[model samples]
Every structure is written in C-alpha cells, then in structure tokens.
Target chain A: MMNLSRRDTLRLGGVAIAALTIAPARARAETEALIKEFAGGKTPKNAGLTLDIPLAAENANAVPVTIRLDDRFSGARSCEEFLLVAERNPIPEACRFKFSPAMGMADVTTRIRLAESQTVVALARMSDGEILVRRVSVTVTVGGCNG
Target chain B: MLNRRTFIAAGAATVAAAPAIAAPVAVTSTTMLKPKGKKPRIVIAGGGWGGLSAARHLHAQGADAEVVVLERNPIFWSLPMSNKWLIDVLNTDYLLHDMIGPSRKYGYELVQTEVTGIERDKKIVRTSQGQIDYDFLIVAGGIRNGYDAWFGNDEKAIEFTRRAYPSGYTADAEHVAIKNKIHNFKGGTMVMTLPPPPHRCPPSPYERACVMAWYFKKNKIPAKIVILDPKPRIMPIGGGFKAAFDELYPDIIQHIPNAKVKEVDPFNKKIVTTAAEVKFDDAILMPPHQAADMVWRADLIGKTADGKPTTWAEIHPTMLHAKEDPNVYLVGDVMGAVSKQFGYYPKSAHVANYIGKIVAIYIAQRLKGQEVKTLLPDNLCYMMVSGEPKEAISVQFDYEIMPDGTISQKQIDIDIRSADLVEEDHKWAQRMYGDFLA
Candidate 1:
C-alpha cells in the first residue's frame, strides 16, 4: 500500500537539520572555490542558514531544495543576495536569489538537477557582511539494472 | 568444511537444481553463535548479499544489538559474477566465498539454518534448529522463481520444466546444468526467455544470451541463440546489449522482442509467446519472479494503505519497515511493494548489499534510542557483454521520493562495452566481496 500521507512528507522537512551539517567532501572544492570568489575573500560560516534537501533522491534531474534564513537575521539588516550550488553539476552555481531588508524571512525553494552524487550548498552575504552557509550531501544515482 | 572447489564441484556434479534444502543443523551445536546478553536480538533470515551486508554493518557501526545471521548455506556463491563462469571465462572459484569470514571479522553470530516461519506477535522466528526470539528481524530471503506463472498448478509440467530447463538464480546445480547445456550444445537454435521486469537482475537474460553467443562464436560452433524477451525492447540497458550483439556476434544471436509468453511446451522444447512462436534444440526458460515463499507465509506480502496487493512485503518507503509490523524490516530483493509503487531498484546483488547497510543503520539507531534518519540505497551494476576483449557495460541507479510518495528514479549508464569497465567491475566485485566476507 502507498503511504502518500502528506503529513509524513511535511514532517520530513525540518528533521534533516542535524544530518545535513556536512563538512564538505573533497569533490565540493570547486563549488566552494566558486563561493569563495563570490564572497571576495570573506569566509563563510554555518550560521542563520538552513539548506534543506533530501539526503537521497530518486530523481536527479529535479530534486526539491529549500533555503531558509533563521531569526539571527533582522529585517533591517538581512542578506541582500543568496547563491545556490550543486557541486557535481558541470555548472556548479545552480542559481542566485536577490533579496532586500523588506523581506523579514528570506527563504528560497526550488528544484535542481544533480550530475551525480555530491554536495549541495546555499550561500548568502548578510547586511552585516558575514557570509552565511548551509550545505548538505545529496546522493544522486543513475543507471542501475532495471527491476 | 566446504571450500570453493568443493562447492563448485557439488554444484557441477548435481545439476538437478536443488533449491534451499537446508542441511538440518542441531540446536545444541549452534550455541556458539547464540545470543548471550539482554541486548536487542536482531535475527536476519537468509544471509545472501543483503543479509550479510546488514550483519557486517551492524557490527561495524557497533549497533547495540545481538546480530544473528541465519543462512541456509554455509558458503556463498555470488550470482552477479557467474555469467562468465557459465561460459568458462572465469573459474567457479571466483564465485564462491566463505560466510564465516565476515561473521568472525564483524563479531556477529552466523547460524546456518532454514527459517520455517515467523511468529510476528511473539517476535520469534522458528527455524529447523529451534525457535529464536528477536527484538528486530530482517527478511532477505531473495526471490522465488514462480514456475506456476507459466504452468499454473500443473505440477507435472512445472516439475518437468524445472528439471530440464532451469534458471541459474538459486542452487549451484542449476548453474551447472545451464553451463553444461551451453558447452555441449549441438549446432542448432538455442532459446532464452525473459520474464516481465522487476525480476532478478534486469539485464541478465540479455547478457546470458550475449555470453552464450560469444562462446559459440569463439569455438566456431554452428549455433544461434534466440532471445525471447517480454518487454518491448529491453530498452535502456538492452540498447547496449542489442548493439553489442549486432556488432560482435551478429550470426550467433537473434533477439525477439515483445515476446510475452502465452504458452510453453517444455516437453516438446517449444514456447508460444505474444510476439512469435519458437521451437528450439536447446533453451533456458526462466520462471516468472515473486518474493520468496517465506514472505507470503508471514503475511508480510502487503496491500498498500489505499488497497493494492504487492508481490512482496510492503514497508515504510525509506525506513524499510513492514507496514503491519514496525519491528520487522524488509531488505534485499524483497522490497517489492515499494518497488511497485515507486520506481524499482534493480533486484540485483548490489542493491541488496547497499539496502542492507541502510536497514542496519536504521535499526541500530532505533536500538540506541536515537532519531533514525532514512537514507537512500544506490545500485551500481556491471554486465559482461563481450568475452574476447573482456568488455562490460555498467549502470547506476539513484532515487528521490516524489510528493505523492512515489519513489522517482534517475539512471545513468554506459551500455557500451569496454575492457576498462570490465577491470573496474572486477575491482568493484572484489571490494564488495571483501566487505561482505572479510
């Protein structure tokens, strides 16, 4: 029987916080370098940002991802921009989102295509000039024998 | 003790396809592997690819539980790498491993016994030796070749088909028989049939035809193999295999697609299918697949919450628990309900082995009173498509759960056969076998 319980799926959103605090594997260096370029020599720390994505995804072409900024950021001094990266994809920078202090809670939810199994990152430069980062590993697999 | 040589010889000598007739083990003698402490006792049924992986990981992760693996066979014979063995490319020794190596290495208990039944309410597993109580259980008994699908309660027909024409999925005897049949084949038409998808090793029948055709061409034997496939094209993976057949052994292989079998005359060596009727001098009729009998016996074969019966146990899509019994889990080739609803992970050794680890981690987390997070299991499969240059085709599968709870799939593959891929495949097998055994 199918467990298409929308409630269960909804509960899965915030539960991955602990497991998603990945240290970033070696393969993510390119994406990290790109983020570094975007930061212009500023260091990014894991703060006030949560990168939510399924740890294992069946559909590599379009995996749902969410990026939310925590209460640490006040509306008067919020991040002006956010960058999303899929490390293994040929084009690591999936997209960018522009924001302003008018938006109290800055959250970005979108779908991404992963090239293979690798890390996914969300980067933002807050109004205080601090680089906020959230990263998680999304295992992407393709090409297995059919069942 | 049965070594690889002895197991291979036993398989070769007795080609009657002896399925899981477990050598009865006495309970008194199995005490060495018995549970000693009050910790959660996790009894795993069928120490095949998945069971062994779960057992190994449970010990490796230091799960706070007593891991007891119940297997029917003392030695392991891997089915994945046996295609070459069938055509005498690789030695039979390559396919065998000792189950004791991993058990000892991981410090888990390995008990060789046949599981009779499961007492779900009591949390007990009845075996030929005795009943063992468990706090958590893993059902990894592999697949059942349903000859009934074709013969339909015709005991005489089913028995005859099994004896004369058998699939190489189970016992050593079946593999031996198929090997001998191919090796001693006289010049004529040879037939190989494929059941519907979600069966054992998706690209196997195609690969089998390829290897057999390769052998016939290598030896200059005047024979051809006709592939009676049920699927429209065996597409995706089959595309590469079909190309290999045309380019390499064009004269030796003839593939017939959309061949859904209607009737088979096993006694007369003829099969009638939706596509074309074929009579042959030699044939390998693989039975339609279902979960092992134990799955159905336990009432674990599930009907989804919305109410549709699945061929195998229905479990929590990610957590791998039986819908009816959270204490029980499903691993290996038996996650049919999930496979049916979502896209299926190929019912291969790699998936079984990978899923085993996931199941172990989930159970171990629960035992430790930690919030268990569900992880995905990936499959990396390589198939030997050519013999002379030792080339193979590889495929990998990854999954994501859709909003509707359907497990969506993404597949990346190289159907093109190459020598480097073969080497990599060997390395992968060696590493996996090492992880599983030692």
Candidate 2:
C-alpha cells in the first residue's frame, strides 16, 4: 500500500487549477490594467508605438530595451509626457519622461531595474489631452541589479 | 548426513539474500567513475587574463591530456591597455575579444556553460547542462565585487550596475558610468574610492582620478578629484603615481590615505568615511571583492580554518592542488599566494600568458608520463597614467621557489619608462588577444 501526503495532494490540485485558470486570468487582468493606465482610464486602439527587447539576453544584469513612439511632436497639440510601468515591481513606475513641443520626438534609452518577469507598459500623454499606449511582457530568467 | 544437508541449505538461503542487500552500494559505486587517462583532464574556468593564459600554455606544452576551457563570458578583456579607451585614446572594440576563437585555434574545447558545483570524490564538474568529469580543475574566474555587502541597499546602487556609455568599458557598466560622470562634469567635488590591496589593477582608481583631474585642469573647471584609499600608501606604483599626482594636478587633486568609505548617502551626495564626511557632486565607489561564487560553492580549493577561501591555490609552490588532488592547478588572482592581483607582482596579462605557457608544458609532460620539474614564472605589468596623451610605467619580476615549499619574488625591474612602451603596450594587447583568442 502507498500513501500520498496531504501537502502533495494539495500541490497537485493547485497545479491543475493554475494550468486551467490562473495563468489566463492573470494575463487578461494585466493586459486590461496596462491599457487602462496607458489611456488614462480609456482603452487605446492605435498601433503607433513599438517596443524592442532582446530575444535572449546573454547577461541578465543588463537587458537592453528600447521604446519608440511614431507620433510627431511638431505642433502645440503634440506629445507632452511618457511613462513606463512594469506589472511586477513593488513600484510599477520604472521610468517617466516628460517632453515639450520644442523638445522633439519621444526617443530615450536608459537601463531599467527589473524585479522579475513581468509586463512592461509605455504610455504617452499627448498635448491635445489624448493618451496613446502600448504594452509588452519580458521574461527575465535571472534578475540582475536588484539581486 | 541430514544435519549437514540442513546447514548447507541455510547457507545457500543467506547467500541468496546478500544480492538484495548490496544493491544500493552497487548503485552508488557505479555512479562515480574514477578519473581516467594518463594526463589529467584539466578544466580551466574563466578565460580572463589568468584562465586563458593557463589554457594556452597547457595546450602548447601538451601537458594536460585533455584541456577544457569553461568561460561564462564570450570575450576576454585586456585590463592594462584598457585605460586608453577611457579617454577616447582607444576604442572598446580593440580591448575585448572572444576567448573561444583562441581556444579553438589552439586545439582545445571551450565550453560556454555556467559551472554550478564540483564533486571532489567523483572528480566531476557540475553545470546547468550536465556533469563534466575532470581529473584536475583550475578556476581563474577572477574577482567578484561585493557591492551588496558594501552598500546597505540594492536600490541605491542601481546607478553603478551597468555601463553608462554604449561604447566605453565595453562590457563593464560601472566603467561606463564613471566615464559619463567625468565627461558631464561642470564643477564640484569628485570622490574615487579604492578598495584595500589584492584587487585587479592596483593603480587603476588613482589612474582614473589622474586622468579626470587632467581633464578638469585642461578645461579649467572648478573641481577637485579626491581619492580615498584604504591603504597607508597609494598602491603598486605608489611613489610614481604620487609624484605624478603632485606634479600634474597639484591643487586640483587630493590623495587621502587610510580613508575607507563606510557609507554612501546618495540623497545627500556624501560618503561617510572613517576619517571624515566626504561630500561630492559625483562618486565612483570601487567595492571590495572575493573569490567568485563557483569557487566557494565547489570545495575543490581548500579554505582557511576561518572558512575564507585562500587567495592563491593552496597547492605547493609548483601551483598544484593541495591534499590528494594531484591533477588540479591554481594560478593568477584566484591563488592566495600573491597579496596583490595582477600588475602588482607581475599579475599582468603578459605574466598570466607566461604562466599559461608553463602550465601547458607541465600538463603535456605529465600526460606523457614524464616527471615535470618545477618551473618559475615571470611577471610583467604595464601601468598607463593619464596626462596630455598617456604615459605608462612597467614592472617585471621572477618568482623563485625556496626550500620548505615557500615562494619569494625577485624584482627584475621597476618603474622603467619608455617612449615606445605605449607601442609595446598596444602590441602586447594585440598579441595577447590574438594568442588567447587564437
């Protein structure tokens, strides 16, 4: 006769439930939150923003990431500010950049300290009071900087 | 006759049960294989100045029956001439090269894997991929900066975590950050902290300060580059560097000896030291270091009674592994014998290259079942100081093994200057990069 520990049984049940429900729900919630934050409580439908991260990072400590906004900042009603937030960090706001019409297009590059594998969102606020947004999930196998 | 038959039957039953009892023993014994081959399989971890040189030399002499180079990083960086890149005198591309290119060229297998553990009894090297068996192992993984231990919090240390510039220091983020801080200088107090002795590039921090001071004076910026060292004197090139500091940037640069940074208050831009509170507009903190994680994790190298990993390989003067482990050899900064890291007692890339050649010879001879006579290694370090263009000082020494298994250093030359040494430095870097990556 064999015996199964209660803890082991519970763990198996949890794994099955996680495989069936938790992962999908977490992904959906994360996507919804990112969109809401980017559009300032509204859902964005445009595709003017692009995010780039390495397919695979040789050194986890510094994973190079780049974000580009295709929108032009020429008129008085141009882009005013940009915010980058991570879903997993204790503090979600990884970086925030503010720009003026005279400052030019939204292009900036700097290393961000990531806590773990999570969704990263880039949100831009236009001078016309419209919020444009984009989000991408980066899987960091090893956490550097913070570790 | 009946009693005899009964006893024989019982003995047979006992013998039948013996196999079942011995099953676990057999499984354990079969899992561990004894190291085979006439020459030990010497696996050198890290292809930095020390490990690469050891692998190349071992291969050349055909000493190691099988030589395997395990380097985590794809490239080997030249530490000595790298200063040129700091001031835009040289490019970062020229300072770093792929170590595997040379290992393969030299007829050795360079395994790029993260080594996780070492099994001494089974003579196996454990990695994320699988277990690699080796008769001997040399770990030249170099030093690991204990920044976490130095700084109380990880968040405050983020600024120094990666390269500030895309092209400077190549792979080093801290180097790039220091360069950026220097470049964007308006005017304020600049503090450079130096760890206690036995670090890679002894004169590096001071040299950096000198260059920055030179830049400041050249631009006539209202600034001062202050160096805080934990040592009584400056370092390896103590006198020469001090003289240069005095002559070049008299009032602009200040050298404060025996001052160790206790804390860094980023919010206030101040470094709390044992001596006094040093405030600065910008700060470059070089933290203390220890043997890399793999070395401590794998107990192949002996540790002190206090549990600290010995600096040099605890082997005899011949650099062989101590205890019963005859196949392993230790060299360079990882070895506890030398107090100073490379460049102090010939810990330069040139010296490491020379030692690598010697280790190869020893390995080849041992592979052929020939007795290897102990060989002494020569050390050379070229120190580059920043001024108008660049100036350097070179030190060369030879190690002499004494009786009772002790080794003493014989200084061959010190503070030797030359106009063409810069060219020699460049040639040395190229030759080393070519030879190691070859």
Candidate 3:
C-alpha cells in the first residue's frame, strides 16, 4: 500500500468528495469540522485578527493574502498559534502557524490556491485558552483549484 | 544478470542486485595496481555528468588500464533540460538515459552501487557491495540539498512536503510531482525558491519559474508563480531572465529577492521569512545545497564565503585534485575550486563536463610518468527563457591563473536571449549527451 499521511489523505479525500453533489453542504460541515480540529471545539471570539486579501482577486493564481495579530492581541504570551483556512478550496485548511517567544511579532503573508469564491478564515489561539476568528469573503472570477 | 542499461532501456523493470564480495583490503599506491594478471584500475565515483565525461575521455583503444565507474542510481537522468520538460515544452523521455550502456561501450565497468566510504590514504572506495581498490580516484558524486539550513525544516519535513511541492533539482520523480500540480492547478500561487549560490546550475530556479509562467500563459491557466531568491538580485544570467520575466511574464511571475525562507511550517503549508509569512497552493522549495554525503563523511569539506564549513570539496584550482590529497580528484558540483573568473566555479553541467575532460587528461598523463600541465577550463551555460522555439541566453566564463595560483575571472554574455541560442543550447545538450553515452 502507498504511504499517504493523514494530511495527504484529507487532501485526496477532499478532492474525491468534490465529484458528488454533497460538496456545497459538506464544505460547510468540513469548515466547522476543521475549526474544531484546530480549536478543539472551543467557541472562538471574533476579534484581534486582520485577514487582508482582495475582495475580488484579479488572478486566481498568486493572490497575495496577509494575516496579522494586532498589537493588542499580539505576542507569544497572548497568541500561541494561527491557522488559515479557505472555506471553499478543495483543501479548506490552508495552514497552521505556531509561534514562540523568540518571534517578536505574529504577522504572515503568503499566496494560496483557491477552488472558487469563498470566505478565507483566520483563527488565532490565545494563551488564555481563547480562540479568535477573522474571516474575509473574496470573489474569485477564475477558480484556482482544479479538483 | 542484464546490465543496468538494458534494464533501464527495458523500462527499469527492476534494479540490478548488488554483488557480494569478501573482505576487501585497500590498495595504497599505484604500484599495487600492477597485480599479477590485472592492469592499473582507475575508479570514478559518481556516475553523474562529470564522472561519465571522465570515463569517456579516459577511454583509449588498447589502453593498458582498467576503468570502473560506481554510481548509486540504476538510471541516468539529465538535469540540464529538465525545466523544459516540467513546463511541457519538451518530451520528458529526453531527460533520462541509461548509464550502463555508455560505460560498457567505452570499455569501462559500470557498478550500480552506492559509495559508502572512501579511504584516500589506502586508495579504497567502500561501496554497498564491497570495497574496491583504485590507483587514482575521481569523486564527482555531486551535491546534497541542505534542507537543514532552513529553520524548523528537517529532512523528513522536506521529504514529506516534496510530494506536494517537489524540489526537482536532484530526483527525477520530483519533476513529475510538480508537473502534475501545474497541470491540475486551476488557479493559485506557485512558490519557487532559489537557495544561495554554489548550487548546481545557478540559473535553474529562474529558468524553471520562467517556464512555469510560460506554461500558465500558453495554456491560458490563470496562475501566478512567486520566486523567492535569497540573493540581493537575480544571479548568473540575471539580466536576461529578469528581462524575460518583465517582458514575457510581468503579470504571471513575481521575483522577490533577499526574501529567504527562514522557517517553514510544513504542517500548515506556510513559509515564514523576515518580511512576511507566505502561504502557497503549491511550491517548489529548493533547499540550500552542499556536497554529497560521502564527501562530507570522508572529511573532504572546505570553507565557504562566510567562513562556514563548505558543503563542497575544496580542491586545487588548476589541478582539480583535492587540496588535502593529491590522488583524490573532485569534479562537478562536489568541488569547491574558487576561481576569479567564475566565483567558485559555478556548478553547471558545462563546467563539470569541461572539468571532467581536463581531469581525465591530467590523470592519464600522470599515470604515464609525464609532466602534468596546468589546466584552465572554460565555463559555458545556456538558459531557456521562452518555450515556443525556445529562445535562450548564453553565458561564457573565462579565467586567467594568477602567478600566485589564484584565478582572475571575466564573463562574456553573447547575442541576447534569442532563438539562435536555443539551437545552440540544444546542440550543446546533444554534444554533451553524446560524449556521455556514445
């Protein structure tokens, strides 16, 4: 048997589900499931994060996206980890970023692939066991994920 | 058992099994080479571009010597024209050739085994099969990508992420990994990174990015590729590639210099630099590279520009032999020969091919009790900038050996990136491949 890691299986599983009409409904369920996977089902507060991306991406490929933990909610003492998710991408969970005290700030910018127009979410975990959420809706005229 | 060439040409159904040998003693001097029934044997470690070139050059009709080549891989895959294949501009089959055929054709024995250890004093190469003694040794085993250089990036993480974003510099399978991503990508960011210099083919990352952008444009795929180069600006063929990026892929390709990938959060598909944290849909992360493992294991390393221990073998600039041992010669990407003309003799196929030829001549002459002549090898590199008809840029390197044994270097850029040079690049590949195989 081919060795497929959990992440790879999830990615492959996500694409396989896209073929069925259950996608749109399952996408919403998967988003919630992913948030729970990262946040452990804790109700996350909606504050302290600025998820900056284009409202309308001109190019589906190479859309510059940035997420920053504001000074008020910044520092390793306050913020422990960050996770980025595209609600509609074939693989909805983009990445999870962990920070240490050595890191002075919590700011990240990277381009991501998208399957269609969807809301991009950022979840920041607080040292006080609190999870904060920020979401931005972007219209991608051209879809980014073939799957 | 069928030779590796036949196996590879036969679709590499299976790799030839390693041969068993009894406890083997090391041969220390050339005198031991004159055995009762055998001739002097020259063993070339690494069946890469340089090793093959040396084997071909050393092959002479009725030469009173035995030549043997030891390569780890069962099949030979050329890295020169790989970018063209990745971007669907050329056939992928052209990238691979059978090494065993060439070695057998030129009367050299090709042993498909990994060289595990080397004892220079004893003139012995320890392979997975067994220990093989040699009169003269040429080490051209090439480079090992330094995935450790990136903070928080381990070899396992790099290997794990490679399935998603392949660093197609060494492994042929990585090309297929990235090629599939490119074809399957609906639209999204593709991240390609360039490690610091002293890597194989300095212009390759840029060339790959250019071809990728071309692929997006030609296929009408709404995609973008971001190139993160550690250097301050584009390197080696910088002007040519930059111009092509500006004129051809201004919208599709983004070149960001001095943006090193300091740390990678592979679990999240995120890369962190001092400036920003980058997320990618797909990526081709080229980690920093060093000389092959055996070179480091043998303690054949030198120093780099930053006074850090070099990942490459430091060798005599003119002689191509290891600075520490005269009998051991280092060629190709593994050598750390500094040159005034081309800084540290940029690791390119052309430069390695030239070094292999020169090293072969010097070693052959030395074996015959002839005075060895000082050598000055030229560096030639061609980079494909466009896909259709394949317009390319040509770079020529010239160097003069200073009286104090240092080199003074000069660079010449020929007729700008055009269709003519593409022909030249193709011809160069044909000639090099011919020299290696035919």
- Stretches off by above 4 angstroms in model 3 are A1-147, B1-18, B21-37, B61-63, B151-155, B304-307, B340-342
As a TM-score, model 1 comes out at: 0.70
Candidate 2 regions exceeding 4 Å error are A1-147, B1-40, B152-171, B300-313, B322-324, B338-347, B403-405, B412-418
List, residue by residue over B1-438, the lDDT tens digit for candidate 2.
878756665654332222223233432322322234465577786667777777776766656366777766655656666555666667878766766457666766676556677776777776643456886677676666656555656754534432221113223455565556777889988777775655555326666777778778877888888888776555444545777688777888899887877886665667787766798777666666555666666664556789965543455545444444666665555554432112123334555565566666666777788887666665455556555656766544444444434444433223334445566566656666666665
Give the share of true interchain contacts found in each model.
0.21, 0.00, 0.00
Range of the 10 consecutive residues with the lowest summed lDDT in candidate 3 chain A: A7-16
TM-score of each: 0.70, 0.62, 0.68
The candidate maximizing lDDT is: 1
- lDDT of model 2 at residue B251? 85
lDDT score for residue B198 of model 2: 52
CA shift at B437, candidate 1, in angstroms?
A: 0.9
lDDT digits (tens) for residues A1-147 of candidate 2: 011122111111011111112254565566567557667765554577766654433122344557677866766666777777765665556677787678678777555645556667777777766776677777654211101
Candidate 3, B250: how far from true, in Å? 1.1
**Judged by lDDT against the true structure, how good is candidate 1?**
0.76
Overall lDDT per candidate, in order of appearance = 0.76, 0.59, 0.73
Task: Give the chain A TM-score for each candidate.
Answer: 0.73, 0.64, 0.76
